[model samples]
Target: MNRYQADVPDGLSRRARSFVRVHGLRVGSLAVEDYRSEWLERGIPSAEIDRVAAFGERWGGLALPPSPRYNGGPRFFTPDTPETDPSGGWWFEAGEQRASVPYGFMIGPDGEFGVHADRWVPLHATVEGWVESLSLTYHARLWAKSITKLVHDEVETIDLTGYVEVPEVVGLADSWWRGPDSLVAIYRGEAECLAFPAARTAYIYSGLDDWGLHG
Candidate 1:
């Protein structure tokens, strides 16, 4: 079955279109699991993979981390997978230490997106086509962080609900969040949470309710 209503457009990478055509724009598509691990993989069963599919059908699926392998890019597992904690959301079971929560931005007309019970919940977006989807997701992520950009020297951000076009973008989540010098916090929605260490720093999400966090 065709996951999208139309064909792949432009702007998105060849990888994004490949993903959309084969996997139907699912956030879980990036999940490369270690099913044979002693460590546990815990998450909300209600994360509802179908919801991701539905979102992809409506808004647009995003090309997530894996490129540049940083700036929020989720790295492929090394020798040891990360820890799994059920209390918060989905996570690979490594040790006392946990893996970075995987996150992806979903682009929709309302500027809204989806997440799992996990805090760094992945997302699913539905949109016109692959090329069109990338720009939408890129713009939407900037909007979520409440960041601003210059288009012809005018402060601008893409707003699907308004008179806007998906602006040019690359390195989607690269440097998407940084603050207080050498530290940052990335929030996907209320569902997922995570805590991890980077170069001389760390990120922690308590998994608290964030119903209005976007507002």
Candidate 2:
């Protein structure tokens, strides 16, 4: 079994399996410093830098400049958020708020990080297999966003063939086969959105102004 499979919930729907595999590979490519630098470089502007400071605190400490690094953090997902779903794996960075409203990337659970997800796949609902059901869909006509995943697995093979570009997951929930070659991928711009009979959750940005989604 692949190292990523050790943590995968064995019976996950095919799409779920694909999700985990893709992200496991992604997380493996990153080192500890990448996480810290991303926050410091793209971090929201603040005088005290308190948000990143506290965020780093959860990770133990924040390193900077030549040897910046985040120490003692979860292997998958950021430290849990306090105000919302304590059950969620990560909280959207609260610092990048736009027009006074929170707008940032978040993963793990619906409504936990100010992201309202439309359920496409209904798993057991505990969040164990939850992270395995996320992917990116970009709308470049509006803004740019880079998808990120946190996983730890080593693999020599990563097949990029599973990606597809579709119109909508909402349309596929009612009709998609469970065949070996079955997949319903939606692409808005340059990114592909993985869709499934059991995977409709997404960070909703359609109605929010001064706010939009990158993935």
What's the lDDT for all of these models?
0.29, 0.28
Assess candidate 2 and give its TM-score to the true structure: 0.24
lDDT of 1 by residue, 75-158 (tens): 211112323335533333111112353543233222222322234332223222323333333333433434333222121122
Report the C-alpha lDDT of model 2 over 25-46, residue by residue, as the tens digit: 3222223343554444754333
Cα-based TM-score, every candidate: 0.24, 0.24
lDDT of 1: 0.29
Error of 2 at 173 (Å): 15
Q: lDDT for model 2, please.
A: 0.28
Q: Please state every model's RMSD to the true fold in angstroms.
A: 14.5, 17.6
* Candidate 1 local lDDT, residue 43: 37
